[model samples]
Target: MENLNIDLLKKIVSTYSPAGNETRICQLIKKEVEPYADEIYTDALGNLIVRKKGTGKKVLLAGHMDQIALMVTYVDDKGFLRFTNIGGISPAVTYSQRVIFENGTIGVIGCEKIDSLKDLTLDKLFIDIGATSKEEAEERVSIGDVCVYYSEVIVDDRHMIAPALDDRIGCYIMIEILKTMKSSKNDIYFVFTVQEEVGTRGAKTAGYAIEPDVAISFDVTATGDTPKARPMAVQLGHGPAVKVKDNSILCHPKVKNLMIDNAKKHSIPYQLEVLEFGGTDSGAIHLTRSGVPSGVLSIPTRYIHSTCEMVSLSDVKQTINLSIKILEEEI
Candidate 1:
């Protein structure tokens, strides 16, 4: 955990990049890896692909740069901004949280303070940005501006908690791994894809363009170890979770086994991830061009799709180690 760059990770998770609007977070990622990459560019859909070439096999490693957020859909006569969830969001977790706009405007989100707890819905939520009238709110923010729940990265004991760590932690892993690897036999393509929170969209295009011999994606998977959870096997502080199955795709067995073998060989702890509800960038990568062999290395995350997602720093460090070990191999 000490080896990981907390500063960079914090900056990334803090940036507001809802599904279709991922420019700011993408820019933050580009700045971190631009010098290490041989080629860095954005695709038609604004996915940032950073290529670091080698000679053996083409390997594409993708982590999406977007986070779950809300979009300013309408404004009330009283200047309150009405928003729609931009991605799969938990209404229970988002209530009464502060959110920030792209233009540096700040607001507080409230879901109609109620006496009883079970009566809230997205329809009840509204953002108050301190505007006096509808025209005043419109002047500060437009109809399309996106807002991310405001949160700061905090390191407690051995875990890091912040908003958007689901994939930003994955994004951090990709960025750091590329910088750490000096040489390799594979032509490594590190792509910071967009719109993963909405659907595996950006990686679908970037994966097609690269058409690599192998694909590995870094993202987060839900853990059922939390209290009242619906029974999952993964736990925090365990090493990186290797995706075996999820709602979207059955991971390539060879790739998954290779990752597990590498982790054991290097004494890195890992857990088998079976997410009944979500997917990752590998979902798209596995579907590219006549089918590429792909797998995902995931972090066991808690309170996912919320403003304060938590992941073990130890798991994150192990993920970095396991990925680099895989990249250094011939297969």
Candidate 2:
């Protein structure tokens, strides 16, 4: 198996490309994939589409670039920023965390006095940027400005823990695949999508435009390996999970079987994933024009949506190997 590019993964995950604000991350990805792509362009919705032309089939691979964030709604008189959730943010996991705005303004999340932990909510939270008053806060941040969880990527001998790994790790996988894939007969479209954290918006648009014969999405899935966690079959360090079903879409049998067969043929480690909740870009891509067949490859992730989501290095490598096998062969 090929080695996982830890540096590349760290670089991509570190960028603050929250939903509706993907230009910076898109540019970074566009640069990384340009050399390997036959043609590259950005769609109206800011989805970075890189094509490797072929005549066998039009295959679309989507991995969203956007991460969950907080959008400022009001600035209090005392210079604290009140915000609303941009995606599926848990107040329990968000409190006392730090956030960084696009312009480099850093702030700490604070909450009002509450009687109990159950009473904690986003409404009670505020961001302190060290501003003395509303006017001062407005100078650095404005209504509608978004901020992402501020955290650093931590790499161990066998695992990676970082912020925004939900889909950024997916983006990193796609980028690596584009760079290392030797050749293919399918006209492949590698899309670094935006706003997936919100509603799979970018994939929906990109799918319509490409209208590929087959589609696959890369994203993270929750695990049951942690202490007394949900009873999920997936675990880190085992392998990639081939999607069977999720809340948003059912995996097409052909695509799902194709992944399983490829993994078996190549002796690649893999697991079956049936997420009881949550979804991926495949949810939107499969619903495209004429209803394209689609499936997903999920990395077993622990503590998803938290500041330090974790994935195994071995699992990442196996995912890349299986993905390459799927793309290099017939659809």
Candidate 3:
């Protein structure tokens, strides 16, 4: 954590910023970007938009700040907590995991009797806060409180494992670019969007308001390097990836090629991504305002959408470099 940017990245990954509850993480972004941004504001949808002004084509770079979590739905008589998942959380990954609410309330996740794995669902899941009875539980937590996966970021020399990297890595790279970007001719909007995990909601509004001529979303994509993983051309430690296609949008050829060329020109290691499922902010951004050409630079990630997501530090560094290269040049 010697790198100031890396240290900020670790904190962003560890912070709880579940969908619809991104205020805390958004504040962190605001403080970090204020020094370098020409203008900054939060939109009606809670997207944090920062501006670096210039006199060329507008560029939008979005990274969602939301993560999957659970909400307290019902308090059972025996002091157990019945909850509904906020975003796409796998039951397999939630079992026995510690989840924390905004007020620092911690609970251990557990599940009801399941005859088989197919019987598994959010309805069968519960959270235990060690309350003696329903009354005590109500005193501690009430319906409508959200809880995020509770885990500390673990860092090795080359990799980081933690929750919320799905898009915190995006936030990190955007902040680094803002901090260290060279003089640029194109106007840039850095948006830390909300509610992307639930849907690309924030990006849609921000995109229309900014109406960028071109956009590049910073997000993570799956890698197939793990044991028996799905076959993907991208892999962790291979460097950042330029998006070709994903479930949401096909990257614009002109933008994608420019990213590829920038990486090659600068000697930044990179890969091409073809994700069959899952979408990022670019999915919505490209469709805004008469179709802005869009692309994505993804940090190769493993165990995505799970509590213990993993990413390569080298890939992240390369992404920052490549983004600066692309943003500084006239487009």
Candidate 4:
């Protein structure tokens, strides 16, 4: 079990699991959770559910398994691959980056000749697989195949960089909580959700199916500490963030307070998040059934949605402690 911590995180980020295609990452997570979970199942929407037996309150913990990706739309006679985004993506960042498909196909994303910077868009982008013609490109890559940023996880000092830390880091937090948790009376359901980048669709389905007493989502939030970044309070290396509000939903007062209290009681570093845009699984989970009180534990991340997403391992460790504290206590 030496170096197991980073190993787990590296595995999560290294796996390919875009919005609708999460089987690969889920398969890796399922193996790790089986030893600690009372029962495990994958729902129709591809959400991986890991249940731990408890007799008191039902607590649902969610972390998405999907990342933003690109889908091949067409292949030209010259062996160029046209694509459309599978989730919210920035065309500004797509130029000159490599992408990998599920079937191990590798291609370099390139852009069409543009007259001006204003004309640069996703439509102007195409992936080149070095094939000589359309027939060769089609043989290796077909329309509808998805690919994510080609990056690997790296750990240096307390910093971790990867392509999909947007939520895989959240998954790592969940896995650690499942392993370190002691005796508790809460019925904990740790669900590795799917298609969050697309629309939080997996969370909506998982929330309806579980309908737990309380829910907490683990996901990454943007940081404003970087030079000339947006005006936001969250910062990398500060601590995990307690969600107050985001674009999609206003966090329930009680659930938000619970997180604040847990962080204080456990002496865990934390921050308050009021993200002006973007949303998490909690945004959808809180609306399921009559309603479910929910909040988010955010890992402050830099350059979110980019190939080199950065996070502090210190903040990540604190997020794990806070999540464990919440799950071990009754609501």
- On TM-score, the leading prediction is 2
Winner of 1 and 2 under lDDT: 2
Q: What residue runs in model 4 are displaced by over 4 Å at the alpha carbon?
A: 1-4
Report the lDDT tens digits of candidate 2 across residue range 1-331. Answer: 5677788888899998899999889988888888898999999999999999998999999999999999999998999999999889999999999999999999999999999998999999999999999999999999999999999899988999999998988898898888888888999999999999899999999999999999999999999888999899999998999999999999999999999999999999999998999999999999988999999999999989989999998988888889999889967
Compared with the true structure, model 1 gives a TM-score of 0.96
Q: How close is candidate 2 to the true structure, as a TM-score?
A: 0.99
Model 2 backbone overlap count:
0
lDDT of 3 by residue, 83-118 (tens): 888778898889889999898989999888888989
> In model 2, how large is the Cα lDDT of residue 34?
85
Q: Which stretches of candidate 1 lie over 4 Å from their true place?
A: 113-116
**Using Cα atoms with residue i matched to residue i, what is each candidate's TM-score against the true structure?**
0.96, 0.99, 0.98, 0.98
lDDT value for model 4: 0.91
lDDT of each: 0.87, 0.93, 0.91, 0.91
Q: Give the per-residue lDDT of model 4 (tens digit) for 1-331.
A: 1233887788889999999999999999999889999999999999999999889989999999999999999999899999999888898888899999888989998888899989999999999989999999989899999999997677997899999998999998899899988877989899999999989999999999999999999999998898999899998888899999998789999999999998899888899999999999999999999999999999999988899999998898888778778777876
Candidate that scores best on lDDT: 2
lDDT of 1 by residue, 163-193 (tens): 8887889899998898787568888889888
- Please give the range of 10 consecutive residues that has the lowest summed lDDT in model 1: 1-10
lDDT of model 2 at residue 35? Answer: 88
Root-mean-square deviation (CA) per prediction? 1.6, 0.8, 1.4, 1.4
